[model samples]
Target: MTFVVVQNSNNDTMTRRELHQAWGTQKEKLKLKFAALTDTDLLYPEGMETEMISKLALKLGKTKEEVYQIIKAI
Candidate 1:
């Protein structure tokens, strides 16, 4: 549960990682959520917008997959 947290002028917070191990815990949670989703859900055309992805990442707690999809769509 060791994470780096930063506060921005806009009153937002985030973690800064210099290594993969720092993200391991969150990554595992995302992996479990991904595995639990049905194929239909996964293929349901997640909106590939950076803003949308960021919003969903904050709301649903997703990780790189959605970000990758958004980049791919771009």
Candidate 2:
């Protein structure tokens, strides 16, 4: 799979569409990485990368930075 990095105003980089697509393809991997995460937890909205990170952080009990790191690594 290919990813196109998009930089937000806060300078955090993410591939919004690609990341969402990755979630679909990598659902099982994500579940393995974060057992507590569910399909609901993986939902991504357009242009809401920060919100997605925040939601993931809350659900996974990680910091926003940590969530972003995980997403980047994926």
Candidate 3:
């Protein structure tokens, strides 16, 4: 299986609550993993974390927590 390497200087993964801090990298990873996902689908605006999570959960047919884990894993 091909592995996605998160290339951050710190090599640390951010929590869901901190997704905004690491969103640029996270969104690209999400796009690579799910070609169907578009920029609009992952448009996480400032102060709209819940909305972004809801959108992703709806599109992926997953719970919010699952979505959190998916982001964390990448």
Candidate maximizing lDDT: 3
Encode model 3's per-residue lDDT on 1-74: one tens digit a residue. Answer: 22333323345444344666689998999999988899999998676666787799899998877776788788
TM-score of each: 0.28, 0.67, 0.72
Query: Against the hidden true structure, what lDDT does model 1 obtain?
Result: 0.41
Error in Å for residue 12 of model 1: 2.5
lDDT of 1 by residue, 1-74 (tens): 45654333444444333223333443444446556533332322222233444544555565646544332323
Candidate 1: give the clashing pairs: none
How many residue pairs clash in all the candidates, one count each? 0, 0, 0
Off by over 4 Å in 3: 1-17
Q: List the residue pairs that clash in candidate 2.
A: none
Ranking by TM-score: 3, 2, 1
User: Model 2, range 1-74, lDDT digits (tens) per residue?
Assistant: 44667664557675767767676666666778888888887776656667877888888888887777776666
Cα deviation of 14, candidate 1, in Å: 1.9
Give the winner by TM-score. 3
Which has the higher TM-score value, candidate number 1 or candidate number 3? 3
